[model samples]
Target: MHILQPRHIRLKKEEAEELLKRLNISVSQLPKIFITDTALPEGCQKGDVVRMERKYEDKIYPYYRVVVGSLNEKKNG
Candidate 1:
């Protein structure tokens, strides 16, 4: 992980559930991060939630994203 890159962690099943309840939002509602993203921790799969910790002005802010498969763009000829 690069020094400037924020820390990314995959939440456990129970933790994810609690977070959803606390936020009153479903997993699908969270922002999406591709499964191939280098910042994402290993062992992540579809429907998994990743928590990103970003620091600014000496304060840490948590960002959440749901793991999703890569999108394949089809060219219409």
Candidate 2:
């Protein structure tokens, strides 16, 4: 699992699409992070950058960083 940094970016669907096209990548390529709530706020859609953190536990492991993109639909309920 990856996390998003500088987590909040506001952009419309078209803008996000254009960015993806320009970057030659899809949402899956980016990290998966989302707002605290399961559902995005009104007027806010997917393809948004969100801040997140991940923890690793191992004797020889080092800290890692991540960036989240594209909000997923609520799973339960």
The TM-score leader among the candidates is: 1
Give candidate 1 regions above 4 Å deviation: 73-77
How many Å off is the CA of 48 in candidate 1? 0.7
Top candidate, metric lDDT: 1
Candidate 1 lDDT tens digits, 1-77: 99899999999999999999999999889999988788899899988999999999899999999998876522332
* Stretches of candidate 2 exceeding 4 Å from the true structure: 1-7, 37-77
Candidates' RMSD to native: 2.8, 9.2
Every candidate's lDDT: 0.90, 0.44
Model 2 agreement with the true structure over 27-66: per-residue lDDT tens digits: 6775553544443333443446332233345333222112
Give all TM-scores, in the order shown. Answer: 0.90, 0.41
Model 1: residue 22 alpha-carbon error in angstroms: 0.4
Q: What is the alpha-carbon RMSD of candidate 1 to the true structure?
A: 2.8
Lowest summed-lDDT stretch of 10 residues in model 1? 68-77
